[model samples]
Target: MNRDKVVLAYSGGLDTSVILKWLEIEHNLDVIAVCIDVGQEENFISVKNKALATGASKVYIIDVKEEFVSDYIFPTLKAGAVYEDKYLLGTSFARPLISKKLVEIAEKEGAVAIAHGATGKGNDQVRFEATIKALNPYLKIIAPWRQWNLKSREDCIDYAKKHNIPIPVTKEKIYSRDQNLWHISHEGGNLEDPWNEHDKDIYMMTVNPEDAPDKPTYIEIKFEKGIPVSIDGIKYSPANMIYKLNEIGGSNGIGIIDIVENRLVGMKSRGVYETPGGTILYEAHKTLEKLVLDRAVLSFKKMVSEKYAQLVYDGLWFTHLKNSLDKFVDNTQEVVSGTVKMKLYKGSCKSVATKSPNSLYNEAFVTFGEDDVYNQKDAEGFINLFTLPLTINAIMKKEKNEKEKQII
Candidate 1:
């Protein structure tokens, strides 16, 4: 009898490798491992060999780095989105793109189902499943972690060794990691305990503050529609720009965040993330937005940004509400075109100067020692009207207190 094929989103990690073997041994399903290269610094050639060595009938390595940066990273950057006000949405950003490719490959190969290594506890599972539902609801999702009896990484390690599948992780060192162009995240292991301090060795994309050079580096970023277009006036591709920023920012320990964040799965998980490029871009973008956006619109976007972050962090990326919010964010970016100069040193990035074509700042109105902009006496009328309600409330309270004293 001919076996039905399943396309697995393979990472060559212990969990996915074990799942690949288990899917074959237990379900009799022909497995095709697909790895999308999104600048994760992973060696896909060796991963392909390992997948094939472990009984995958075929292995497909798709170079999705440019697509990942251009389609997903830029759009989120344009929207000025930061999940939970800290995470640059690094790990969250890769899931939908990877799942989208999985669906495409599955359809192309006429595969009956798609599978992933995302566990029940992490946000990636939700992100992957939501993408699958949105893109190809017909495909059956085989989530082994949720269904399998094996409950821990130990079980996975045992299974991988039993099946003779090669993987990178070991019992001695186990930190669940998610990597992409924008950032790299470290979780599990010592990170499983919220109180454990992340050692300096755990940082992948940034230097330790103690180890960073005792000097500052300067940077200038050009933006259009809130998307960074250049570095120091030198135009670069989206990926190139981020890569450059990573080098500069990482050298100075500019973007490292350790937080025990609330997962969409109803648990708090500790994560140490290195997001050098994303950190710099966020600062630069906000500085420019300050130049162009009005106070009210900027403040309103802050509220909407919280909602957007919640939706993205919660795996509601494919929902209508997210689409509506994206529309709102995109509209606000119309005038958010500018350039910002920043200084990065010793784990700090601060904006120093900002300019925009659509800047709302008027030197005449803002000057301290001004002559022709307006008369100083005009403020008396404006303040009197503005204080009317407060003044009335105070007078009424005084009269009421006086009447009470007389009655007493």
Candidate 2:
């Protein structure tokens, strides 16, 4: 009898490798392994061969770097969506794109089910399942970590050895990681302890701040309607721009965030993330907005940005609210075209200068020097009207106290 086929999101890593073998040996399902390349530094050829060797009927390696950057990264960047105000949201947005691809591949291959290695305790499981259900509710979703007998990473390693499957992680150096063009995240192992200092050796995209160069690096970023277009007057494709910024920003120890963040699964998890390029872009984008956006719009957009970050982090990417937020964010970006010059020094990136053709700043209005644009005395009338309600309330309180004194 022919077995039903399931499309698995295979990373050729420890968890997925073990799942690939388990799916064949236990469930008796023909697996189609799908690996997505979103600018991670990995050998795709080796990944494909390993998946096939582990009993996959076929393997696919899709290069979605540009699409991931343009569609997911840029949109999040424009919304200024930073989870908990520190995480640049590198992994949060990547899951939806991956889930979309999994659905596409499953349909193409006529697979009735899709599987992933996301654990029950983490947010990625929610992200993947939510996106998959939103896209195709009919397909069966398989989450091995939620159902499997294996209790720990050590068990996974032992299983891989028992099945003769090669994996990169071991009991000694068992840091679970997810890498893409935008950033790399490190979790588990030493990171499980909140007080444990993050090891400098775990950082891949950035150097330790202590080890960073003594000199600062200066660079200018150009934006086209809130989307990063160039670095230092050199225009590049979306992926290349991030790639270049990562290199430049990494050298100066720009983006390394270690936080115990509240997970969507009702638990707090500790993670150390390296997001050099993303940090720089976020700083530049916000600085440019200061030059172009009005005070009221910028202030209100900050609130929207927080909401957008929460929505993205909570795996509500395909919802109607997310779509409406995107429209609002897009409208704000209309005047966000500009260039921002920044200085990166020892783990800190600060914007030094910003200029935009559509800038709302009026030099004459803000100048300390005497100018025809304003008269300082005009403020007296404005302040009286503005303070009228407060003054009346204070007078009424005083009169009420006097009445009480008279009765006494």
The candidate maximizing lDDT is: 2
| TM-score between model 2 and native | 0.99
lDDT, candidate 2, 40-66, per-residue tens: 899999999999999999999999999
- Which stretches in model 1 have alpha-carbon errors above 4 Å? none
Which one wins on TM-score? 2
Residue 362, candidate 1: C-alpha displacement in angstroms:
1.7
Model 2, CA-based lDDT: 0.94
Worst 10 residues of 1 by lDDT: 308-317
Error of 2 at 336 (Å): 0.1
TM-score of 1: 0.97
In order, candidate lDDTs are 0.88, 0.94
CA displacement after TM-score superposition, residue 241 of candidate 2 (Å): 0.9
| TM-score for each of the candidates | 0.97, 0.99
